[model samples]
Target chain A: MDTVHYLLEGFGTALLPINILFAFIGVLIGTAVGVLPGIGPMSGVALLIPVTASMTGGMDPAAAATSSIILLAGVYYGAMYGGSTTSILLNTPGESSSVVTTLDGYQLARQGRAGSALAIAAIGSFCAGIVSLIGLALLAKPLSEVALKFGPAEYFSLMLLGLAAVSGLAGNSMTKAGIMTIFGLLLSTIGLDNVSGVARFTYNIPALYGGLEFLTVAVGLFALGEVFKTILHKESHDGNLAKVGKILPSKQELKESSGPIARGSLLGFFVGVLPGAGATLASFFSYIMEKKISKTPEKFGKGTIAGVAAPESANNAASGGAMIPLLTLGIPGSGTTAILMGALIMYNIQPGPLLFQDHPGVAWGLIASMFIGNVMLLILNMPLVKVFAKIIETPPKYLIPIIIAISVFGVYAVQVNTFDLILLIICGLAGYYLASNDFPLAPLVLGLVLGPMIENNMRRALTASNGDFMVFLEKPISLAFIVIAVLWIVIPFVLKLKGKKVLINEEA
Target chain B: MSKTFDRYASFIFFIVGMAFMIESGRISHSAYGSNVGPNVFPFLLGLILGLLSIKLFIETMKYQNERKEKEALDYKKFLIILVAAILYALLLEPLGYIISTFLFLLVGFQTIEKGGWVKTVLISASFSFGVYYLFAEVLKGTLPGLPAWFSS
Candidate 1:
């Protein structure tokens, strides 16, 4: 069937009462997750996986997957909208992607235009979401069809490129990021070897045979790790909240932002489609681009409506763009997408070229739900933004502990094992120390999620080639992928050697 | 960062890599039909990790230790909450979800800040009971309920 026909079917599924409710709840929690400082989109989505799992327990596997993903994707983009709320009002970004928004968002809020800034952000985000969804719809079939022709060799190389891209842009130090990636890959090797059915690193430990649980590790690293940071640092929000006056923007204000939103959506969508570059980078790039093209550049960082409009739109669009690589190529470009891929895998639904053909219901349903979820976010944020703003004032005292409780509950509910709970705590400690020391956690998670697939594909390719290592170079597509992967890692290092600053994706 | 932390982490990672490389040899060198073996992937990864750790160590050696202005961490509070979490995990299956969760939250709330005893109790009770009822009762998912003796 054509894309339009499949999309209509997807809308039928998405608009189902349960799926719509899932989207609503997902975006609601997502906005809350974004508004709160301690948790990010990664942790927010991770924490909810098990809860959503149980919530959809009674449904058929296919229906369950659709509903759960609808909610999770809602959280992902809903966060992009909610993040701007804090940036504009508190000058503290709710999530890293919103960091650029604070440049002009806070300035606008200071100028008593907080309401307009927020409204524009919501509008920009809504427009960007629709644009990217349209992009995803147009690109999904073509991209997956191309990916379907890839041999094992090409697949291996492409995945390697994905890993390399993530590690290259992950943190302040590429070496550290590379190490974390390798470490995660090593950790993934602990389970039973899929090909040989031989235990490699299990050492007869029963739990080890299944490998480390991804959900446990994720929650510990992102959720508990952030919690530990809050506890140790004793973070307190003492900044006076900027008063939000006039909920709607003036027509002139809206008119000024139209071009910026459109441009930001296009730029952000392209950036998001590329592996490694994420919403954080997209927002930064769009902001810079807007500044360069703006007739009144001086108005930027001083409450320019375009300033709030561009980056906010860009980040949301970038998130939508990131989904393309994941759904079509089975390569997650960012940390959050990696977690989302893990969730998909948990449902026994692999996200790759075959995903569109095998699970059209899931693929199209998710795309459709994003459209519905974006509307919900725009509607929710427009009137109830003040309620969300109050969430920033939630004392860390109550917030921190409850987060701990939820983490414990979520992990236990899913794994149903004491070992996982213990491991969760240990990972939490490890996550805190590693993150504080500038060891990026995203690459590690990405590596862990992609590790098995990379190894399996490598083995398959080598098996096909009778162990010839040069097979990767023999295939033109594979050779190109490998070259790009090498360039991805090496170019950054070269630029650093020349004292040129390479933009890093801190949100990843 | 911390120079000492990096130095230690690199050293530790080096050991982990070496251990993986050495232990991978225990796995059979070949899978029945494939020319490649299960051990190949981990072995290569371990070797690369070891080399990277060495690189990291050497890089750390070149840095002059700049003492950063350290912020006072709430060690006592953190340690207390951490210990409570550990205990909570340990006692979860034994004491049941509600009791263990309630106790953990109560401890966690008080440890983070001293006041709000009554509010803490209410929240802890509501959350623990609420989740248990919602999950076990409402959703029909399995979670350890009250201990056998207490329930009986």
Candidate 2:
């Protein structure tokens, strides 16, 4: 009942004309980002952070944070819907989460069922979006309430669990992921110390005082890094697009998809709640589940509507589910959400148990705006599907340079300094080289974002326990979290040793 | 994964870790009302990283010497764009936003694929001017403008 009242108030915040406009623009741009294989949601959100910051420069701080977050979160989920478009039409997934969709979606397109596959994807995404929102609303208060009781020891342990979970599942090798994570944490320590006010790595450099800017590093690694990759290893996306013979799914197709959509929404939401497992993992699992439960499992890869519907629904739901930790526990479950968390931190709006208490407007408004954004995507995608399909034809010659230009403009406009710009380019080069060598970028980002917080809690806990390291084990909840963190890493290792296939997220 | 690259990365990371560990030794040991200080976390993390890098280096030895595939890299095009971008960054303040952005875009678009002069110039000008107009004029955001001599 309290949730209902809060949601209604949330609708009040979300319905403001300005908020609605932000949501519309966010989804619109999100679909385009998803359509462009060069960028994923992580870079998409990172690139827009500065642009949105400047755009909302006029508003009060609270409203500015609310509106921009609504837009960014809209981008996160909207990408899920757009990812399916490429899979069905071009036999290319716009993002990694849609990789499974290509197996059946391209098959469907070959049979002139491209329209059906697309419509089903949109419909499934819409349903999953709604389902996840409801789940978010119901579980948010309880989860945060539970989190509020956690002391510094518990928090330090919990954050460790989060890091371990992500690193364990991030890349092919745990060693590389651990190395990247440690490097990020080390990087985070460069700035002025939050508590002691002593500089660690400045060496008297003025720009180093603020430490390496998260915005600069993220934009360089994900956005410019992608641009450099395209310039060098050029992808030839000149394949013929499947023709759209119909605009809507047939009645039989809808009936075939309804069950898969429901199951996927439920499964994806739970998977999404777990740390480190993101939309890509959710979609893969949902697809496998659908095949297992199907009456004729053999039809899965042969233009079946269930294959198209299940994964699309699952990915969208997982994105929504990913928000649960960010909003409640203040821990980002994946790379995209980590960027989103960074955006929130920029606004001085710490997302955690107190987020609901301190700023109901930002939290609830964001939740309600997602509902509206999902509806906007459905209406916009259905009618303008072909128009968006044309965006795929946007020439690389113009697109590549323009993206580079925007990234430069964005970082410059915010930092207003040449140092960050130079750093951005360097990070971009390193990003390209490292990513190509099977190193996972996500855990490094996750580590960077969580580093200061984890350190703060660890120091606080240690101080309280008089520098006793056993305090982590003394607290029951902290002990449990540490045990789980250990199991999360060890179980994966044991499985790998047994030659069992351990599912890894390629680009979370 | 390239075995050589992995080996070098691990070696480099090990050095970085050791540097952090040794450098942290210079900081104060404790802060007010607490025994733990800022240096503790970084030192611990640096030590962990040193061990992890060794583990990573050891893991690389298990790799088969896979034949290297000579990828057809567009090094000429990439270097051009990279240098252009670095120049744009260095020149952004001195030359101002519009001039630097316009020149960068012009170079970038042409270098990406030559022979779309009219479209490229028009786009570069409009984008540079349009963005400057929107961010500075409309949004009232700060940006370096044309020099007084140039404006006159």
Candidate 3:
């Protein structure tokens, strides 16, 4: 009863004319980001943060945070819907999460079923979105209530677990990812100390006192890094796209896909709830699961509607699921969510147990908007699938420069300082070189965002226990978290040692 | 993975970690009633980072026989854009948002593709002026206006 009441109130906030417009723009851009080759949702959300900040500059702070977050979150899920378009039409996935969709989706397109495949993907994503939202609505209050009981020790270990889970699965080598994570953590220590009111590594520089702005690092690493890669590599997305003949799926096509969609949504949602396992992994797992479950598993790669339906549903659901940890536990499950968390912190709104109590409007409104955004996607995607297909041919020449301009503009608009712009460029160079060399950038961003909180919690725990090193081990929840964290890293390393091919989340 | 890059990166990280550990020790240790202070976290992180750097270094040695693939990278284009971007940043405040952005985009578009000057200039101009007017005038957001001398 209480959940229903809160959800209704959320709809009230979501349905406001301005919020609706924000949602529309968010999804529209989100789809474009998804369709475009180089930009993933992480950079998409990062790029939009400053733009949203400037756009909502006129509003009251709380309302402003809510509105901007609404748009950013829209980009996050709307990307899922758009990624399937390229996989089905172009035989090249727009983002890594849609990689599995390409296996059967491309086959279907070759068979002149591109339109149905696209339509099914949209429908599956819609269903998965609803399922994930309902799951989020039902679980939000209870999870936050439980999280409120955590002490500093538990919080410290939990955050450590978050870091470990991400580092383990981010890139090819656990060692490289681990190094990036530590590097990020080290970078986070470059500012004034909060507990002692002392400067640790500022070197008396005015800008260093506030530490490196996460926005600069993010936009530089993701947006600018991507731009530099495109420029240097001469990679272009222009290609022949398969024609989307029909906008509607036939009755049998829908019937065959229904089971996969339902199953994939549930599977993806749960995978999404885990820290570090993102939509790419969720989609991968569901496609494999569907293969195992199907009676005619041989028909999988040759254009089965179930193949397109399942992975598309799973990725969308997983994105929805990823929001759970961020909103309820204050832990971002993926890179995009980490950027989202940083954006929230920028608004002076801490996301955690108290989020529901302190900013119920933001938490609930985001959930309701997701619902409306999904419906809008379903309506907009079916007919516009052909139009979106045309986006594949977008010239890298113009897009590249404009993205750079936006990154510079966005960072400058918010920071209003030259130092940050310089830093942004430096970070861009670092992002390109590091990423090309097998170093994962997500863990580094994660480390930066969670750095202060991790330090604060670790100190609080240490102080509470009279500086005992065993405090983390002494607490049961803390111990469990640390143990799991260790296992997360060790298991992956051991598996690789045994010559087992481990699946890494490249989309991060 | 490039073993050479990893080796250099690890070595640098090793130094960075050592630096952090050494520097954190200089900060006043006890500011509150509890013994734990600002330095402990960084000190611990730095030590672990130093150890990880060593681990990464050794790991790089395992793949010493790795082969290098040669692909033609457009260093000229990249360098030009990089320099242009830095110049754009340097001149942003002095020349204002409109002029610097227009120049950067023009150079960027030209560098990426040589011809269609009319189309390129139009796009570059529209984006620069379009964004400025939309942000500063329409949204009432702040941006550097035309240079004082130029406007006056």
Candidate 4:
């Protein structure tokens, strides 16, 4: 009952003309970002933060944060919907999460059922979005309530668990991921020390005083890094696009996909709620599950509608599910969510248990906006998918340079200094070389975002215990979190030792 | 993965870790009321990073030597664009937003693919002026306008 009242107020906030316009613009741009191959959701969101910041400059701080977040979250999920279009039409996954959709999506397109495949994907995404939103609304209150009881010790341990979980499943090499995570943490400690107001490792450089701007590093790493890769590799997509015939799926196709959509949504929601497993894993699992249970499993790779439906739904649902931990626990489970968290922090709004109590307008407003955003996505995607498909034809020549321009413009707008611009370029180079060598950039970004909070909590807990480190282990909840963190890292290493191939979440 | 790159990266990371460990010591040891100081966290993280880099170094040694096909990279193009981007950043404030942005985009488009001069000029012009007008004029944001010499 209480949730209902909050949600009603949230609806009132989301329905405001400005907020509605922001949501509309967010999903619209999100679909375009998804349609474009090179820009993933992380880069897309990072690139837009400065733009949104500037656009919302006139609003009151709280309203500004709400509108910016509403738009950004829309982009995050809208990308999931747009990703399937490219996979089906061009045989190219727009983002990593949509990789599995290419398996049957292209085959269905080849059979001239491209329209049905697209319709099913849109419908599945819509259903999954609603399912995950329901789950978020239901779980948000209780989860935050549980988190409210956590002391500094528990928070320190919980953050550690988040770090370990991300590093455990990040990339091909856990060691490399660990190195990146530690490097990010070290980088975070470079600026003024928050605890004692002592400047550490600044070397008297005024730019280093604030530490590395999360926006600068993120834009450099994801956006400019991808651009550099494209330039160096001479990557150009010239695939022939599949033609769209009918705009709707048949009754048989719809009926067959309903079960997969439902099951995928539930499965993906659970996977998403976990710390490390994300949309990529959820989609992969759903695809395999569908194959395993199908009576005619052999038909899966040969253009089964279920193949297109399940993974699409699962990935969308997983993105929705990823929000649970961020909103409630203040821990971002994926790279994109990490960026989102940074955006919220930039607005002086910390997302956590206190987020609901302190700024229900931002939290619930964001939640309510997502419901409207999903509807906008379904409506926009159904008729305008062909228009989005045209986006694939955008020449890499123009796109690449414009992306570079946007990166510079964004960083300059926010930082207004040459130092950050130089740092941005350097980070872009390092990001290219490091990522090319299989060092996952996601954990690095995650570590940078989470590092200060982890240190603060650690110090606070130690302070409470008179400098005894055992305070972390003395508390039952803290001890459990520590044990879980250890196992999260160790279990993956053990699985590799046993010669079993462990699935990694590449998108995260 | 390039074994050479990994080996060099591991070594570089080790040096970075060492630098952090050495530098963190200069920070004051203890805060006024707390036993833990600002220096403690970075020092510990530096130690862990050093250990992880060593592990990465050892892991690189265990990799079996397998010659992989190396794709030809467009280093020339990348270098050109990179230099252009750096110049864009350096000259942005001095040359003002429109001119610097316009010149950068033109160079970028041309470098990526030759020809399409009219299209390139139009796009570059529109983008620079459009963003300047929208952000600075309408949104009331700060961006260096046309150069002082030109305006005067």
**Model 4 chain B: lowest-lDDT 10 consecutive positions:** B1-10
Chain B structural similarity (TM-score) per candidate: 0.97, 0.97, 0.96, 0.98
Q: After aligning candidate 2 to the native by TM-score, how far in Å is the CA of A418 from where it should be?
A: 0.4
User: Compared to the true structure, candidate 3 yields what TM-score?
Assistant: 0.99
DockQ comparisons of all candidates to the true complex: 0.90, 0.89, 0.84, 0.91
* Local lDDT at A112 for model 3: 94
- lDDT for each residue of candidate 1 in A115-215, tens digit (9 for 90 to 100): 99999999999999999999999999999999999999999999999999999999998889999999999988888888899988987889899899899
In angstroms, how far off is A71's CA in candidate 4? 0.6
When summed lDDT is taken over every stretch of 10 residues in candidate 1 chain A, the lowest stretch is: A231-240
Which candidate has the top score in lDDT?
Answer: 1
* Candidate-wise lDDT, in order: 0.95, 0.93, 0.93, 0.94
lDDT of 4 by residue, A1-508 (tens): 9899998899999999999999999999899999899899999999999999999999999999999999999999999888999999999999888999999999999999999999999999999999999999999999999999999999999999999999999999999999999999998898999889999999899999999999999999999999999999988788889997687999999999999999999998899999889999999999999999999999988899999999999999999999999999999999999999999999999988999999999989998999999999989888988899999999999999999999998998888999999999999998899899999999999999998999999999999999899999999999999999999999989999999999999987
Off by over 4 Å in 2: none
lDDT of 2 by residue, B46-80 (tens): 99999999998999999999898789999999999
DockQ of 1: 0.90
Better of 2 and 4 by lDDT: 4
lDDT string for model 3 (A1-508, tens) is 9889999999999999989999999999999999998899999999999999998999998889989999999999999889999988888898999999999999999999999999999999999999999999999999999999999999999999999999999999888888889889989988888888898799988999988899999999999998999999998655568888987899999999999999999999999999989899999999999999899999999999999999999999999999999999999988999999999999999998899999999999999999999999999998998889888887888899999999999999999999999999999999999999999999999999999999999999999888997999999999999999999999988998899999889977
Superposed on the true chain A, the predicted chain A of model 4 yields a TM-score of 0.99
